[model samples]
Target: MRILIHDYPGYAFPVELARALAHRGHVVCHVHFSATIGPKGTLARMPDDPETLEFLAIGISGTYRKYSLLHRFLQERAYARRLEQAVRAFSPEVVISNAQPDIQARLLATCQDMGIPLVHWLQDLYSTAIGNILKRKCWLLGALAGAWYRHVEKRLISGCAQVVCISDAFASEMKDWGIPDSHVVRIDNWAPLADIPVMDQDNPWSGQYGLAGVDVVLYAGTLGWKHNPALLENLALALKERPKTRLVVASEGLGASWLAERKVEQGLDNLVLLPYQPEESFAAMLASAKVLLAILEPDASAYSAPSKILSYLCAGRPVVVSFPPENHSAQLLSGARAGIVCSSGDDAGFIAAVKDLLDKPENAADLAINGRMYAERHFRIDEIVCAFERVLNHA
Candidate 1:
């Protein structure tokens, strides 16, 4: 089967998914669009042309402002044009996108005209209320932008042939937005296991961050605006009494620069901020950590699921997560008995939970074993990739 996979957000998960499908013998043509003009992900340059598959590349430019005249127009023209062209050129049996709703709507029309099936892979939700609140602070025309997003969302979701969500949390969010049960399905996210050599190598982070002798409590991912930066400071302060412990945050995105400032302001002598590491390095660092930290803010909607949990499990490390108990991340950790979940707003509870994990090394070790086993059985990329191939062939 010929498949065209589209993901403009430039995140790692979507790119990995595209490659997985290609590995399964699908003639996959991957299309990536960026809101800013510059070299971003390395995967953007990778091609399937050596195989039976094809590859397409396109770039779109706009300021980060969500509904600015420039951003919306770029989305309407350049991004949508890339989607339309990829579908036309690939002559795909199936078209897959990771939540480019507005662009997806445009492609759906083009696909219907060309008699091609459209499939949407939703990793998260952009609810009218939540998305507006997120970008409204930065958008120049607040009310108009909010209305425009809501309208676009409705049009896109209504037209897709199938919407594949990464979790029940996202699936429920789509249903709440009025997409029928028949139109939406759940397919959890997967990342391939990294090839990290098991050997004694100098810590990639030991010298610069003063992590020489301390055991790390790590958080590895993009440190975006969505994260409460102050929480890191608070964690630092709480761990201050434990001199052997260090909170090491390896992150990318806007919040990264602020990490140094917050560390100074909070007198976080034990907090270390490392630039985002490559995939192999990330796996090594996570595997070395004493504990992993995953957090979600209280206002985060049903899309609060983060891929960090998978990394922690895949790394065979115990995790301490902060999110609502009913949220998918919390549910997964609790069901696996792999981590501790604290209410998103409970600062004291979160701190205490962290200390409990620190105090009980034996319990933490047990959780680590459980986490690795769960990841192997349920979230292994090879297994999930095979499942995706079956779906595409049958769809």
Candidate 2:
């Protein structure tokens, strides 16, 4: 089968899926948006990649203005046109669309026009999330925009051949949107275990970053609007008492900027802010941390699950998550005994969790071992590929 996967963020697991499918003799073309600001996968082709697998990065002419509504809308519309052209050129039997609502709506129309089957890979409930954020900022205009986006989202899902949701909560939301149970499948997200092997804390990358001898608490990913940068600020303040501990944040965008400003205003010498690290150093960067951190605002718990948690598990580290208790990520941590989970607004609990890990190295070691074991057992690419093949064949 000829398969085309448009993963807007160009995440690691999707690239792993594309390679596995190509290795199984399916011709696959993976496309992603190059201008997106986040930690990306190995987008370039490797020397050992199968000949049938190809990668394409579609980019806009200017910087993406994520905070400006008008500029963002125009940029996304322009990007949708390029995406349609890419689909036409590939002419695959099945196309998987994992993107924002605006791009998904346009791609649905393109698929319908081209007489192609489309699989909607539901990563987040974009309309609901957008509406909640906007309503907080401006009640009247936000309500109108949210209603319009919800209509567009419903129509896009209705037209798709299959819907793949990342969590049970998302699947339930789809059912509420009137999608049949048979049309929706829940496939949890994962990390590429081979790409992220467990490394020691004193590895070369850690030494170069001056983290070899210190206790490091790291947050490495996109710090966007949906996240709470204040949690990180609070962590930094708490770590100030421990003179040898450092709070290292490797990220970009709005949240990163906010943290930077706070670091200056508050004179936080222990806080280290850096851009996203290169792919080669990812595993070592994660390993350098004594405790890894992830955060989610309460309002985003229903729609977004932090994919970074999976990566942290693979890196053999104990995680400290500030997320809702019932959210999928928090549940995973609780079930695996891989880390401590705190409620979204529990700043005191979050800090205490970190302090506990730092104080009890033996307990932290046990949690790290459990996390790596869980990743090895569950993140089998061959089994995941078979599941996806079943969905694609039926679609």
Please name the candidate that would achieve the greatest lDDT relative to the true structure.
2
Local distance difference test scores for all models = 0.70, 0.92
**Candidate 2 residue-wise lDDT at 5:** 93
Relative to the true structure, candidate 2 reaches a TM of: 0.98
**Number of clashing residue pairs, candidate 2:** 0
Over all chains combined, what TM-score does candidate 1 have? 0.84
Q: Per-residue lDDT of 84-143 in model 2, one digit per residue for the tens?
A: 999999999999979989999899999999998899999888888888789878988778
TM-score of each: 0.84, 0.98
lDDT of 2 at 129: 80
Candidate 1 clash pair list: none
RMSD of each: 3.9, 0.9
